[model samples]
Target: MESYDFIVVGGGSAGCVVASRLTEDPDVSVCLLEAGGTDSSPLIHTPVGAVAMMPTKINNWGFETVPQPGLNGRNGYQPRGKTLGGSSSINAMMYARGHRYDYDLWESLGNKGWSYNECLPYFKKAENNEVHHNQFHGQGGPLNVADLRSPSDLLERYLQACESIGVPRNHDVNGAEQVGAMPTQVTQLNGERCSAAKAYLTPSLTRPNLTVITRATTHKVLFEDKKAVGVEYGLKGQRFQIKCTKEVILSAGAFGSPQLLMLSGIGAKENLDVHGIPQIHDLPGVGENLQDHIDLVHSYRSSSKRDTFGVSMQMVVEMSKAVPQWITRRSGKMSSNFAEGIGFLCSESDVQVPDLEFVFVVAVVDDHARKIHASHGFSSHVTLLRPKSIGTVKLNSADPYDAPRIDPAFFSHPEDMEIMIKGWKKQRQMLESNAFDDVRGETFYPVDETDDKAIEQDIRNRADTQYHPVGTCKMGTPDDKFAVVDSDLKVYGMSGLRVVDASIMPTLVGGNTNAPTIMIAEKVVDSIKQQYALLKQTKTASCEPS
Candidate 1:
């Protein structure tokens, strides 16, 4: 068995960072296990190639949610990156740090060292924003956050339309306030995608102490009573065990992390009994507090169609030309993240912070761009940022290879639906403004927006995930019965094990979860190092007098 000081599972956003940062000491040996292959695909490297990955399994785990009762019993499409960067590899590449209050809320929820001031350092530590080098964003870090290498005039018109609707243009959405529209900062370095792998893992691969094994499916954590000592995984049709001398970190994301927990018999006692699996520790909150932002897209046909993303015969010609340009200089229409512009706002003015998010895509993205259209158009997504509805990820079987059953019970709260209706009305008002008159062609959805009932129906029919799934293994105080991890991200009642990912978020942040997820890894790894400082001293003493 290969022995390591730290064993990090799932080489997605958090796993990659955990492994990369831990190996920086050179004395620490870290092993990262990813079920998918390396993030070496060309599509995974290009910004616009996310469209191709969203619909297919190429460097992605295109998992579909169980039928959502709140969404008219429709199954939601969830495309998570299975390769090295994980979802960061295949995501839309928007670099949003979420609202500052989001972290304050974490602190308010009985979690110390999670206030905006405390968490800001971690956010800045992992960020390398090309612009906005102030107290809010960092200039040099592993994760590259840059402005759009190539933005379309159509996006400018969209911003203009937002401005006309009394919405101010935010120079930086990740700045002091996150309530206005602007060009999205992307995870790109010189026009190419800067996934977690490209930022942290790739640069650290030369370290002889760090070992990354891809295409390795982890079954469960091997525990000595309550202490997680190692992980049993499979590779090349063979089962292998690797022991971790220090700790086992589960960075398997929101869904996969909890599923792995349940598979390891560390979930609700009843769930473990139903599956005929032996229980290790009965932690009722292991896979319970699931949440995600539900998005309702309002797509419109673009009269000009020249700049927007669509599959017109003329667009096909343009794309063919753009591909060569992108190949040569890494700058063209092919460099777009598709979701170029975004904004955050409160659905109701009474709320302290923005509760809704608007994502403006250059393409008429119907169904995450799964619905192909031959015409030129644009789409705006109105996301219910803090949905009241909770969801879950449960193990379907004892088999680790089986996909977990995911049900993000969206729109379950009547208030959430009401907010969606408000967002729809606001979104429509923005689109119908005179600023978009030159380019806005026609409304593709809402057969009739005659009344609030009609608008509500439209939202229910169109509402789906914005792909930010989180809070499966919640971080809470010990009194919180549903809390899975503590403020230090240590799993409850477990020794030498922790869940460090979006799953630990008690509440979903007000923006994209990618940057926050990376921040969690950066923050937690520091805590791990502090907690395991004695191990270093023990090793040094063994090499000295002994």
Candidate 2:
């Protein structure tokens, strides 16, 4: 029976920003509902605790893709954030805004006011970069971004190897260029993880206009005459309904948002009928055009004494020693981002833009969740920047509690496989480069150097998702049958409902999705503010002297 001016569903990266921004107006009451518990776990706060969260279900949705034909019918594991801050709290914390061309593509696809120039301000608005303060970065913003302090000496050599391989060294990936190997900047504040909850929600929780309810699973959006009026959700074991007087915003990320929309009978008619849900709207794009980045990790042991993998125990001791220094001076090993560095390279020499991207991790990551070797090692993960393959997401059953079916269909396109192969070959070349001549050790993979078939088979067996999902509910012109939302992010055939999460992206951004999702929320918040202000002015003028 409770009612509010606005109801925002899901407290992930985008929802947190939306709820926080909407509640800025003292008169506008806002309610935020999250399916997971509070982000109070120590793993959620520590910078290096992401590894622990990967296997646990406490803060993850733990959904798996249906058998994918692209990878020899293997089901890919997809872990999504289920907690208050969502995946931002569990992610590797790499702060990437994606290529400027990515946003320009959105503008070209009929998305007005979504060009790189127009969206850059929002990116700046959300960031409090501790490194630089020029046009690309802001001084004081909600999200804190800073450089990693404890990079391994081997990582520095990896960067040099990239340069030696004709890849330029980028000073700032978020700046003018995103096409070079650079140390990753992370979302951290004073060595602690800075999730969306920490950046936006924590500060706004005490506001009287804001109410945050966790462990509340939203069942569906209540609609009257095709307009969203409220939501029905349950917390713990109790069920309740809350009305939205103004709007219902869905920020349930790429998977959850689309699943909620479909459950509410707002998706494709055929799908709704199959799931035994009555169709309210026949929008077909609710769960189509699924996209994600597939990553292949290459691990190598180090012969050089400087490799961090060999010195992990020493590094731990060093970190312990440096923690006191960090507490006193706010600098040292405690400030490292763990993903020490990254690189962007072109798989095809003639290609103008970088087609392959690389991330260098200080730890040895072999299996999905298992790192067997105790020796010193580093991981070079290569991902195709632009994948040609498209996939889909659907409901497994009519029940709202059932997890939706997801199919990433990675490497469906032959070009994607080829690109990955080229990237893998490049990884080997980098390891053999003179920069690593003294430091290079044994290759964990491709144990039989002479078996070409084994190398290809190893790639298929080892590939895993990079966890960046998008384009399930894409933005496009109405004529585009699969387009769920218009360029302005307004859902088709809906009066007061909008989706402002990663689901609105027409395609996946080239890098980490956290920054891009936050940017979308920032842009949508401005749009909502302008519309609400205009409505208020109109009502006030009409009431005066009438």
Best by TM-score: 1
List model 1 lDDT by residue over 421-519, tens digit each: 888888888888887887888888855555988787777777789999999999999999999999999999999899999999999999999999999
Clashing pairs in 2: 309-376, 310-376
Q: Which candidate is the best by lDDT?
A: 1
Listed in order, each prediction's TM-score against the native is 0.97, 0.95
Q: Candidate 2: where is the Cα deviation over 4 Å?
A: 303-335, 447-454
**How does residue 490 of candidate 1 score in lDDT?**
92
